[model samples]
Target: MSKIKQFFVRNKKKILIGLGVFLGLLLVAFAIFFLNRERLLQYAVKKVVQKVENRYPADLQIGKAQFKGLATVLVTDISFVPENQPKLLQIDTVEATVSVRSLFLGRLVFKQFDVANGDVTAFKQDSVDNFSFLYKKKATGEEEKTKDAKEKSNYGTILNRLIETAFENVPDGVNFRNLGVIFQNNGRTISMRLPTLTVEDGQIQGRMAITTDSITNTMYVNGVIDPDEYLLAAKMYAEKAGGIQVPYIQQKFGATMRFDTLSLSITDKVFKNDQLTITGESSAHGLVLNHPKIADEDVFVKNGALKYVITLGNHYYSLDTLSEVRVNKAVFYPQLTYETRPNRKIGVKIDSPNIPANDLFESMPPGLFDTFQGMRANGSFKYHMDFYVDMAKVDSLTFNSDLDGQNLEITQFGEQDLRKINREFEHTVYENGKPTRTFLVGPSNPNFTPYNQISNYLKNAILTAEDPRFFTHKGFHEGAFRHSLITNIKEGSFVRGGSTVAMQLVKNVYLTRKKTITRKVEEALIVWLIENLNLSTKQRMYEVYLNIIEWGPNIYGVKEGAQFYFSKRPSELTLEESMFMASIVPKPKQYRTYFNQYGELRAYPRYFFNLISGNMLKRGLISPSEHASVSSYVNLNGRAGNFIMAKPDTTQIMDTLQLAPIDLLDF
Candidate 1:
């Protein structure tokens, strides 16, 4: 103790000097912080906002920045532009509290961020929409460019691609208060009532009510993102607010669909252009969807429970084939696929467990099969549909199916049945799927003919030309479906029907002619119903189809077609005439122009007729005698039909001169 006292007495002045030096350094630090505080706050906030606003094509700014508490900053006059929008969004003020210790290390570590009272207006123009751009970049171009390059080299699973889009630089927490969003597009506006939206950790949850087109619904959604952190903050909010109250809205298929309750489990890398798998359950109630091209009597899902897993790929931007889906209590697997170059295939497969016929019917919107729903149905059935495509050529578009059970029942009729077959089914205004038109082809036209009255040659020719596998297939064929699928994908349009007799019958009888998705879906449903219900015998269905199908200008039935073209009864038509019938079936009106100035059929018609004859013979559809009789000459002036004579052997005949048949499956 004595030695310590002596040392202290000797160094009192030196100790005082050291203390003054330390105080001077502290004062300088305080002075620098006070002088540059605004600049630091602005730098930190602007950096973060810019990162968050990268997806928005607008300007964002803050004004009147000032210090609040020791580590809190208050920024006023926050605005996001362009300012001329009818629903401009203006945030009156924002407060950010950061970690003071982090500031000392030159890092901006946010503790809490809050945005209060934001008012936003959104509207659409005739040619453009304000929110349209929001999703325009849904696929990030830069990220995509890099990803494409990587795909070329790696071309792995979609999950690999998803990994390329990594999510980083996420915020600790963000809060919004009194936010309002109104959207107007195409003279229709939807308003969203979202009192608050908060994003923290790895979850994006909200509850909101949205109204548009005089319909409203409340949506509640809770989703887990970035499963890697699912455990960290899983219970963080339990101690504070049990749950957040959020309001939001979603637009799908150009329509507003409501979700009463939605629980989602999705990976966090979605925004990063990486692989995304979303598993969710939804409860929907009485929601009538609206689309610009949708019918006024738009279909609605009243109430239902659904659970689904959706997966997306990076290269083809297509859905994966392995996914589970449930509606009500029924379970099904739906797969949509897009392949790369050389293969270039697009396909869809729906596999469902056997289900009750009425239950299945009731689950789907009745209007989808308004005409077919009247058919009596009983029993349970399961089916698999394979829409095969080869996007390399124009010929291979096939929609094939296999039905496991016969659960439908149909009533029979006499010749009067032919009259009922003539009813005009719903038809499309065009192939665009908007605005439907009723094609009145029947209600029992006088030209209708019974199955027995129709010529067997015409039947064989139509079967061989349209669908050789029609009798064996339920709705579509296997080889043809695969081939046709490819062709459709290549053309990027439904130019080719790639349909079987059953599908064609449903289309001509119960749906519009438009090539839109709606028509196709309706056509599929009706075909399924008819086939499963056995609404009519195949023979009767064919009779009805021939009677209702469009033949030419003002010509609706085969009877009218037979009298108009050959001036004879269907039964009296010869084999050559039958081939002509089949050839012109696709373009009956165009066939009328094939006659020369002399008023006789042209060489082009004879050529196609002969081609189909050879095809029929090769397929063993026609006997040798029938082939000979039909191939005798052309009908230009009572000549038989056209043929390329050579060795009689089937194999030898095909080896010479590439006869190149008319290709009925050709567009």
Candidate 2:
């Protein structure tokens, strides 16, 4: 040990000198790197431009790029132009400071970013667009073959990564001046200009001016963000006194939406146990919406808010039951889940627990519930709904909904009185938003038929064809509604409506014929009021329904319809004649389609007759003898027969009728 120490001491000087030389060389190399940092940055920029140009159908150019400070980069005259297309992106100058530690880890984390002047414009003419290439994928043959074999996506992981990446890209400080984004398609253009936008110390302030064709609007935005905690709160409002009008929707979709103050916030985002949960809140005040299909006038809401908790798992996404939705003073809880594995399924549940009747009435949107505007009510109502559907087994779908009122009563009426149907009143028929005819719906009218005067066969047939359980149920037939929902889902379109006799009666008596959600909802409210309050007896309501519903073109009520088709009074109509009248209720204007040029019933109508007759027989509404007495053909001897006879005989009668078996539950 002593000899080794002596030898080490003798070489210590030489070792120290060698170590100093190595350190000096390392310092010299770092100095050289620092000196050529600008060149290195430019080369890196060139490489990135080459890569982008090679991968996309675009050319990226940067006139100059250099290092301004230790971790700051300055770029000027950057442009990205697609081949044979307009320039997609252009920037006059940009300066960004990146995290030096992140740079060593091969990641560019911006600490501060500034843009002096820039513009991004997407243009489309015919079938080509300049910006679509950003989302276009250049998949190889191998990738295409392996795509189906790829493992199922982990929604939790994906969402977590998305949130992380988004927050990572948010710089601590940002300053943008004179930035514009424009989108032009065909002849329409939508442009937004940001004169100035700044974010400092987690606070954001910005001003945006939007132009759609000839209309322009300005908005002010203010927000606060916490990057490390994934928290954000933002609000947007108009520069003027009213709400901010959303641009382009009115021109493109024929819809208008405006909001006085829109606020959004993300309170928390947590990832644990292979799941991601996010909580947020959104609120709007003085919201206005308008569309031809939604309503004739603008729908206005005073205040609305939603507090939501969303969760993402491996094969499912869910909105937790903790979510609460509030409109004015009314509040409800909603839960929704969608699964992608083990047979795709969707489930939804909503619960509103006994809110005040007055609050509920006041919560209704203005234009939508005009009939309930000034309505005063007492007591409270609770609602619950649970719906689930498996795409693979839609036939086994489950749907249940209930609205229970606790001694609910109306003290005052709105624009339209609810109790008018109890007495004789003038009923008007509207076609295409115009009143075509008006008639008295009582014994005073010559053609008006009393409930008892109408043949039982006619009433039974109409009930069977329209709503089999109308007399037994309050206002809604759950089975028929379920059938309608199933059919609509299978068809992927709205081809059926589950309207009961009472609903139809309410619609005919108190609502317009125009098909709108507002009108349908109003019809439902009226039906509920009438049924629950016993304002009109079941027989009286059915009587009014038969007296007001259209059965054929220019034909109204059972008396007119029976005479128009069979030249007989309602009480004198035969079973076959009643079935014929029932069949034409859905499409009164196209009744001729059910008959041939010879005025004989078509094969489908014959099957419909048998179906209705069979249902009536099962319900004991008609005896076996009466069911067997139904004729296989309909004889139209009134004005309708003349129209059918005028058509040329081009349809060939089928020898063997083949139709899908109708669901017994549908009736």
Candidate 2, superposed: residue stretches over 4 Å from native: 1-90, 94-114, 120-162, 182-190, 212-215, 241-243, 248-254, 271-277, 311-318, 339-344, 597-599, 633-639, 646-667
- In terms of lDDT, the best-performing candidate is 2
| Model 2 Cα lDDT, one tens digit per residue, 47-88 | 678778888888898988777877898889999999898999
Per-residue lDDT tens digits for candidate 1, residues 93-171, read 8787877566555456766778787767777879665543432333468888775555443333434333433333345
Error of 1 at 482 (Å): 3.6
Q: At residue 226, what lDDT does model 2 achieve?
A: 91
lDDT of each: 0.58, 0.82
Score candidate 2 by TM-score against the native: 0.79
In candidate 1, position 205 carries an lDDT of: 57
